[model samples]
Target: MQILEEKTLGIKSWSPEDRPREKLILKGRASLSDAELIAILLGTGTATMSAVDLAKRILLCADNNINRLAQLTVKDLVKIKGVGEAKAISIIAALELGRRRKSSDADKPAITSSKLAFDVLKSDLTDIPHEEFWIMLLNRGNRVVKKQKISLGGVSGTVADPKIIFKLALDELASGIILAHNHPSGNLEASVADLDLTRKLKEGARLLDIQILDHLIIAEDRYFSFADEGLL
Candidate 1:
């Protein structure tokens, strides 16, 4: 009879070097593949699948794109056969920690250019299915005082309420503001509503004595900056 390495044998029967946790400890984190790292987070597997095998299935759902995998909701993960709520939560927590670390590492203390703005914002906006509007409230020196979410919507677009925006800026005592939103379709072009909103906000900012410094349309890993294009 052929030797069975799967089923009840599980990862325990595998050679230490082949096990994700043991490999991570022996070989260091850099030596582990993406699936291996995820397998460690999963901790255990189903009756039919090993932890590594189950993690591979999860990666397949994201098409092996780490960015897309980070975007998955807890509900999206639990739908997978072997992933329970606890395992799904662990995966989400690990991804979120990595994301926050990345954002902090890319931090720009001041808002001097659109490129810097994009660098700071892309961590929050990229690799997601929905559209979200956000703003950076800046002081007189163009230093970021606060970053706030304005609204969220479906894949096509989101709404930004001028009244709420104005209230936030005024309450923060911001002297300038930068508007940004994501395009889940990966199209960076500003739609008509985007243009109209920009115009209205510019006029409102003028009345409030606040400078409308820039508007950015983020898509995927790239960004479209209105001020850079002389659209402001």
Candidate 2:
């Protein structure tokens, strides 16, 4: 049914089966779309809008990117017509909890697989509106020694100096390192720049006898791994 655009009646006036809260109870949480789940968080909307209508507008503010939505600040959220400070805080709090839960799921100390590396970093980098380069230092067994940020840049690209990356790895006495960087546009394809940088870093690490295990392009929910794809 048509239910939005800030002109729908209040959620309470809708059929009980159609309300977000009731839908969750009846159909299970997985059945609701992201907007509907957020509507449940909002609780109510403005005089002219249903809760789902307000939630859709909030999602629109982030271009309907849940990852990007998680990044919006309270000050940024309250700027929306129907979003007050309390509602803004609620949105931020819920997203933060999700982030923490993802991070908490990283139970292994070793970065044994590309999926593991993605799990380790996605909580912080996924859906961000900027690019960032990070390196994971690994011991001989591929257990993580530390994760270091190399650089942060705009939406399109970020720079990672091989010197700085190696220096940190060397300092940690790392035997191998995995390269990671986020693509805010949610594109997992390795750009020309991404390939060039990976080649350069691989050669540099080879000279230092430190293995470049993989270079991952971390987009939103997935990643492109050079090693996994045999590009390394």
Candidate 3:
């Protein structure tokens, strides 16, 4: 097999219609393949490899799984040939920007179901290396007022203070809230501490006339909903 150099294999070599960036501009982002989307962000590769080829190699490192991009770190990315510091930073930044954009778009609409709630919070929470407690404050109409990270803690951390969780909600005059936390181990199962914390929050919310809509335990690619499982 013959080796194709970067310049020969690059999007620059393709007709404008075939280039990922040009195609995206003409046809929209949804028209691009995962590799094509990634290649556009990568910009270029080393002299020996095209950006698209490098993107394919990077995706293959994650088992050709686009979703696994969330799991990649800058260190992991730099291990790839042709992915120097600048390219690695660009790739990671692009992925994070996409994640933030998706979250913002998804959160624009009111979360009406457990599934929708899970979808909005999973990406933000599940990959967190440490425990984070997020309070999703909702208006009387059940539309989200805001989602705030109330606290960050260590492994096996516990945050059971209803006052801490509800202070912001009360300040915003929120009628309801969802409690969300992540299990860094990627197990969606709720621990005893999780159950206890939810129960306490429910009681506190009830006393304050604020509804506890749900408690979501987020993990990679999966989540546990207290309301969905009849635990709340």
Candidate 4:
């Protein structure tokens, strides 16, 4: 009887008009907030709160950024009052599916300009807290063949060896390559090390009959392109 009482006053107690699933069906998914969509995954909540309320709490913890939420672990989600291991796993799984769909292989865009190249790889680098160097191997037509992480380092800097960069480009039979790294400091200004490395790699690529298309410095919301700045 106690269990039945608890169940009645949870999501089942809400009006059909107020239920997340019912609201979604009637009004369409675009009408729902991030919390509302997350509530659908939650299914139900503790006796003291509705699923929507629980989801709201979770989003609040992540500052309402889905990308930030994606970085969370199951333990992180379960730290909330109304969430348990099962509900946490469900949320993580749903977010991972969304990420995989966004970066699916069927949608690889070509690198026609520095901006286009920046758009292709920004999502992978922008939110990272440390330094990372990646090489985008491109075919003769400038279409991306592969994105390889060359190195990862601390907040200040990372090592990008020209020999390894050229070797990968040669192995892949790439005609061009775009170099990219993130500045966790949010500064778009290229450091002395950045400029020096770009020159060295450009020289190496020229020797191998491959083009060094650009070097991009990624920030949280913007980027600096060496090619765009006429520095490449």
Q: Please name the candidate that would achieve the greatest lDDT relative to the true structure.
A: 1
lDDT of 2: 0.88
Deviation (Å) of 174 in candidate 4: 0.8
Q: Name the better of 2 and 3 by TM-score.
A: 3
> Estimated TM-score per prediction?
0.85, 0.71, 0.86, 0.84
- The TM-score that candidate 4 achieves is 0.84
Give a tens-digit lDDT track for model 4, residues 45-128: 777788888898999999989878987889989998889999999999998787666555566878898888877777678656
Those runs of model 4 whose alpha carbons end farther than 4 Å from true positions after fitting are: 1-9, 73-78
Superior candidate under lDDT, 2 versus 4: 2
Question: What lDDT does each candidate get?
Answer: 0.91, 0.88, 0.81, 0.86
Poorest stretch of ten by lDDT in candidate 4: 1-10
lDDT of 3 by residue, 36-64 (tens): 88888888766777777888998989899
Screening candidate 3 with a backbone cut-off below 3 angstroms (N, C-alpha, C), the clashing residue pairs are none
lDDT of 4: 0.86
